[model samples]
Target: MVLSELAARLNCAEYKNWVKAGHCLLLLRSCLQGFVGREVLSFHRGLLAEAPGLSPSATCRGGSRCSPRARQVIKCRNEIMHSSEMKVSSTWLRDFQIKIQNFLNEFRNIPEIVAVYSRIEQLLTSDWAVHIPEEDQRDGYEGETGSYLSASQVNEVKIELLKEELEEMYLQAEEQEMLPEEISNRLEVMKEFLRNNEDLRNGLREDMQKLDSLHPPNPKRDSKEPGRETPERKD
Candidate 1:
């Protein structure tokens, strides 16, 4: 029932633009979530930027920062849903199509749907991108649309992180350079002292053995020796 009505609306030129755009956005979101396996409404383009090189570090740190384009798309989606007239301009439509195309391109080979939709976008006419920007002028502009970081702020944050890494390296280098020579010298001295003690101990043992051989103990004399006399018998 739903697909029949969808087909009928798609057949109509007037509703075709909105229907196709809506379907494209929906499919795009689904593909993104299918790849990310998480909510993207909060961090649409930011998540896309990180999704291709998805890492455990990124997954553990869950908050997503929105990209400028993703913010614009979100605004466009919101305006369309909230407005009573619900119309868009050709310029905005083209931009939206490009945005979705770029987003889906990030995860090209991972999801089959992404490849299918990308080809579909290429084959389909820009008539699908026929909406006008003026129609949605009341919604918001680039700077005013969504809550996203300015390019300057992002740069500043990157610089600060780099500065921290550099600082850490400098401290490590300073610690290593300060005591390496001193520690090595101390180790060499201790080894030399131990070698000298070992040599002295060996020399002393040899000298004692030599003296023992030179001065052998006097042998016990027998009672019948000529110089020996027996003492008178005693009780």
Candidate 2:
């Protein structure tokens, strides 16, 4: 198929599985080709250095340069021999063929992908399983005892604490009681002191207001005063 048509097919939901399979295959092919190309180039560079008058630098630069006639010959040979080699039997080629067949099988089977995903998920969740304790085993005696405190028992403890606090307050107050008559006399003295202070403060405030009113400003003081001089003439 044309590359554009293949790309369009890859975009369709119906062909998504095939597209993903093909993409993976293409990536693997590209990586293998790159690795093989590097190996071939290295070998060819070394081979070229053995040729007459070719230094390592010259070999590295001119290793891939071939004449147009040689290119046509190589292309024609590849076209004729490459397709026929697919049916040929050789040990290394058989292994490669088997691998390709297996890859194609896995690519066609969606269950293989699902199974792989499931296995990965299982592996991930295995850590979670390891963290969780078995039901038969108690976590710890201390934690179990702490967790065993019932709601009613908790409330009873709180009530007992409050009762003890109240009793202590009562005993302290009983030990430190004030005399009744002395307390009453103190209360009466405080009332008298507060009333006297209020009256004194009110009197002070009224005096301040009266003083302020008596000291009202006089703007014509210079003219009204007996020793005041009038303005002299400029002449």
Candidate 3:
């Protein structure tokens, strides 16, 4: 539904083929002023020249205070995604609370976007780490396994979620410039996740193919390596 709206608004001819959230952002870049839409906007490296400037660190600490609110949102997302500890500081999360609201306000006219406002507020105002009851802990995930997800509608939602994860994997491999180890670990997690979800495994063959093709490239050699060798051998 969201994609349909974006397709209509952006006049994205290939929007029907777009399967990930990043695709929407990619299209949005072409509309921004001073942008030729050529460079890698996926990294949010090109949004420093407009509207509500990015918040704390839009790719770097003490981020641009004059870029689009979207820039702040994107940078905050990148920070969380790239965190090795899989955690964020309270100050950072609190700042995100402010930034996300500001960003969402930018699209107040979009009903679908605005609909999640209350939900976002609920999430942000609470503890970042969910505190499950002791009973739930003891029963563990076994109590809920496959029982609630049997509906076709639920399956479709799961499929979309898998596509989003695949999209992020693509970004990590092709855009984030992650270390080879980091990419490899994430790849294994994704592979195992797919293997467990038979429905997803069967439904997302094409998506999985793209992920497979994104095998991280070999790490680039650093010119400043400590043991760098300079043998005088002719090729």
On lDDT, the leading prediction is 3
Please give, for residues 138-176, the per-residue lDDT of candidate 3 as tens digits: 111223111111234334544665566667877777886
1-235 in candidate 2: lDDT tens per residue? Answer: 2223323322343232222222233333443455457768988776876785666555344567755543543443233222211122234333333444444344344444443443323321221111112234222232321222222332233233223323433343345454444333433443343344342233234333332243333355554558767768897
TM-score, one value per model: 0.35, 0.20, 0.39
Tens-digit lDDT track for model 1 on 36-87? 6543544655766778666535544458677777777777666544333324
Record all residue pairs in model 1 with backbone atoms less than 3 Å apart, i.e. clashing: 88-131, 88-132, 89-131, 89-132, 90-130, 90-131, 90-132
Every candidate's lDDT: 0.46, 0.35, 0.50
Q: Each model's number of backbone clashes?
A: 7, 0, 5
Q: Report the error of model 2 at residue 98, Å.
A: 5.1
Task: Please list all clashing residue pairs in model 3, or write none if there are none.
Answer: 52-67, 53-66, 53-67, 54-67, 57-63
Error of 2 at 96 (Å): 12
| lDDT assessment of candidate 2 | 0.35
Q: Against the true structure, candidate 3 has what lDDT?
A: 0.50
- Models ranked on lDDT: 3, 1, 2
